[model samples]
Target: MLVKMYYNIKIIIFKLACFKLALPADGATGEHEDTSQPRQVTSTRRTQVSVRGPDSPKIRGEVHAPIRGLKCLCTNAHSMGNKQEELALLLADTNPDIVGLTETWWESTHDWAVNIKGYRLFRWDRKGRKGRGVAPYVKKQYTSLPNSVGSEDGQTEMLWVRIQGGQGQRDLMVGVYYQLPNQGEELDWEFSGQLVETVKSRDVVIMGDLNYPDNCWEEQSARSDRSHRFLAEIQDLYLTQEVHSPTRANALLDLVLATGNDLVRGLQVLDHLGDSDHCLLEFTIQLRVSKACSKAAALDFRRADFNELRRLVGEALRSQRVRELRI
Candidate 1:
């Protein structure tokens, strides 16, 4: 009876060992390949992207002519999305001295990547707001200051930098601003007096996505208190609205307002760039002596080949027979 019981125990233990051997090893996922099934992609991240417009700005290796003193370009990105890359490329192609962008919709989590080659970026983030922000990039080559001398503080979502150059070294108070929809009237009323005071006799250029419809521009708005108030401030400040063309969908959302029209020149609306609803507002400083009209000679650096010139001079002198080679 004892022998029979021991034999039964051994048989049960053998069966348990066989079952354990058949099972998968520790930490095994039990994964299997199925040719008919689509392979799953691991570690994929969702890329936030924007719908690029038909007239999205393209990158060209060509560099445009530089404006003396300052050449500024303003545009509303609507939503920068992945187009900051394209925007930087476009800026390199156009080569503006300063760039103002509105509606960037930039968030804290976003990786700041819209750095042009030689510009210093000043940003005023729109905290707790969606699809609204303001920033400006000023070229390092220019003489710019953190703030203009004798300048006062501005309202929220506004940034200013003083550029001192042009005819007679005239100082320009450059700024980038964004007033939220239904918030314009308040801004005009609240900051109107302060802004006028802050600019304080300096030539002013305050630009960005004002968001006011073009119909309201100049004097088309009869009932819009905000429009009237905004326009009133502009007139009171002696700022000329340089952008007459529609920025987005037949509406002039982006604006370029200058205090002294004589301080700026060649106001032009450029083609739509990279996924932006608005167009580019391009202009240069209007110096007392315009480069084109003045007889003042400009150094022709682009056509100059210093080495070739040196070689030519050396050859001419080497072959010439001098009448008297005196000191």
Candidate 2:
């Protein structure tokens, strides 16, 4: 049995040697030779990337400018009543200096809930109406006051605020406007008049839902007469629309219009606030604002010496007792 096993192993080794001798050498041209070059093995690991969506805000050319100026946010809330918490979250996340909201659907009754902590609210609600309203919230540090520069006797849903700028800078005129869809020509003219008056200022920023879907901001043209008029008005006033992304659906309804070319730096269209279909608009204004100073004084306990304080108190008590004994 051992001899038979050795014979079988020797036969297997002989076959293996015959097969190795029959194989072709490297670079030998034969029917089994491989003539193609070796393929490069690329890395299978993926690189992290961020892709901006179709509804993402168009980054303006002034992105490289100084980012130390005022940070502002605007959104057509559709109705701000139920979205205050969401807005508050957005406020905390963005830490904007100014916030403008259109179609707030606010009434005098909403005064109780409209005030946001660290921000002063200024609003213009449609008289006797429930749907249309505009509100602007300025940080508590900024000295902001309601103005009538861009309002037409409550005819249009608009609110204006004069924000005090830093030293050596003029006050910024900020307006929040909400143009009603399919409104009368008179209302359009009134809103246009408001823009005309507001644009007269050197520093002006107007933002809201204009509702002119036919106007293409990229081409700077409009098919409808109303959009054409608005486009023409913007051109005439030398106002630049910094928001290029679609705020509502496929249309660019929300806008951040600045009077001068340099007044706007960057604008971003963020996610919808709460359940509102319209997206949020975040932008930066090219003006420096004075920092808010705190009036309350705080005691510093970190550097305090409890032993020294007790010694001083005992000395004062002893001195008082000595004086009392003398008296």
Candidate 3:
């Protein structure tokens, strides 16, 4: 009976091992098996987020806008004189991208911004009774930064503007300056030195009735060095014409200096506005990117050794024997 029980137990253990082998492993099961629960398929559907390009449809209007050239006008309107009507007419007809008006009597006048159609105005007021100021009128099509600096004596005004161009964009820092009349050499030197020191390090255009002409005025002969150095540092946009006037005479006072690329090509003195003492100065600037220089090609000239040639000639002469047979 004990032997029978041991044989039965061995048979049962073999059967159990076979049953365990027949069953499926932990994660491995045949597709046809209905005994196991169906696996929940975790979806891997990639959420495709649409990305927008720089020239996408949302910004198509701005991308499609045509790039245009920028035209800047600079003038010293002679604040002592009342010539608003004349200035308005001239500005209206000229239609400059920006107009820099210097020596404006801002303290005396209540209305600073003289609104012209298709143009936006910016002005800096002067201190009490000084009558020195600068104003810039930009076209409505373009945008400008908020005014930062104004003049107290109505002699200087600085404004910043951003202009979009075909190739890229440009920042314009324009200054309208009107030096004190009859300030003498010392004052002129001091003022010019200040201006040079202030603007020499930055990209800027100093334009307006500088009062100091390129040529030595009777008043400026003593301080000619200061004026010359100042003019030399900044490229004179009015080089071709001695004096930009309706009539011919050498009196170049109003000027424009381009700090970046010498984009200023020409400056034309427009027809005088009524009886205003100062004339309007208009400038034409062409924007362009600088190009890289190419390398030069090597020359292929033959070089001869004089000593070698001489030695070869001597050897040839020595080798050749002039044999003369006497007849």
Candidate 4:
């Protein structure tokens, strides 16, 4: 019985050994199991991506001009919309340093000033109750004068700014004015006279939608020369006429006047009148400072000094010794 049990245990052990050898090297329990080599470990890191909206456009660098200084624009503010944006883009293409908008019907609470990329804004609107007002958009890089001097009518306003020229000298002062369309002839005359007087003391460029026809004599003689006295005042002040309409018919009422003999070397009538009733006036003045005038300006000739010099010269001449010395 013991011999028979030993033989049965040996047979069982042999059967278990045979079963283990029949299995695959990976010890798979099923016939359909995958025996291919293991896939190589892929070490990948998760990355983040940034996205921009569709409306954003890439910005180009600053524009270059033959002349460097303050460039001015005068446009009547009809309203702010797609038309207005087109106008702004048009002005941006020209790259004016300063822009004066008249009849701007902007609420004091809203963003009255817009970003021209590298520009700052100085805006003044009449009281909300008041009908209309003026605003100036100046380039951010330039320095603006502290005070903007003007008349009380609110029909016209001026911006005073010291512009550094490419020659590295203070060469320009820009004054932007906007007068109402129907401000009586007397008031027109008065305002024109005031503008001329104010700008005469400085090197100025006066640009605006004066609302008076360039050919006042031809179009509205009934209003008379008094209504268009601003043009006369500008001409009388020795400010060279940089831009004036060529034909009385379909002519632009906008004007650009430059002080002294610097003639407007270039004038362009931009094709953007669809946005506003008035066409865009663009002109360039070649400013050449006179050395003699500059020297006179630098001299410290105070009123007291002038009086003393005259008195001393008179006394020295009266004295016989001084006269003899000259003789």
In candidate 3, what are the lDDT values of residues 136-204, reduced to their tens digit?
777765434332332333233444343332222223345555665445665455544444543422335
Q: How badly does each model clash, as a count of residue pairs?
A: 2, 0, 3, 1
Q: What's the lDDT of the predicted structure labeled candidate 1? A: 0.62
Which consecutive 10 residues in model 1 have the weakest lDDT in total? 51-60
Tell me, by lDDT, which candidate is best: 2
Worst 10 residues of 3 by lDDT: 52-61
Better lDDT candidate (2, 4): 2
lDDT of residue 99 for candidate 1: 89
What TM-score should be assigned to candidate 3?
0.53
Q: Encode model 2's per-residue lDDT on 1-327: one tens digit a residue.
A: 445544654554443332222433221222231223222222222432111111111111111222358898888888888998878888898899999999899898888888889998888887876887889999866555666653346478777787644443445788898887788998888888877766653478999998888888889988998889889988988988888889998988898898777788877888888888999888889864333334444444554555655565456446654466552
TM-score of each: 0.61, 0.66, 0.53, 0.56
By lDDT, the candidates rank as 2, 1, 4, 3
Question: Model 3 clash pairs?
Answer: 132-153, 132-154, 133-154
- Model 3 CA deviation exceeding 4 Å by range: 1-67, 146-167, 182-203, 214-223, 235-249, 289-327
**Best candidate according to TM-score:** 2
Residues 1-327, model 4: lDDT tens digits: 445544654554443332222322221112231223222212122332111111111111222222443455566655543355665676778787667666565565546445456766665566646445556677755434323344555344444444433221223556566666567765566566555555533456766666665344333232445444654665567766555463113755566666665545466655443456665665664544322212122222232344544555466456676455553
Task: Give each model's whole-structure lDDT.
Answer: 0.62, 0.71, 0.49, 0.50
- Show the lowest summed lDDT stretch of 10 residues, model 2: 51-60
Pairs that collide in candidate 1 are 57-273, 57-274
Evaluate residue 122 in candidate 2 and report its C-alpha lDDT on the 0 to 100 scale. 87
lDDT string for model 1 (188-307, tens) is 555565476555545578888877783456554535766676777777777788777787788887888777767667889887768676788888855332233333334434445556
lDDT for 190 in candidate 4 is 59
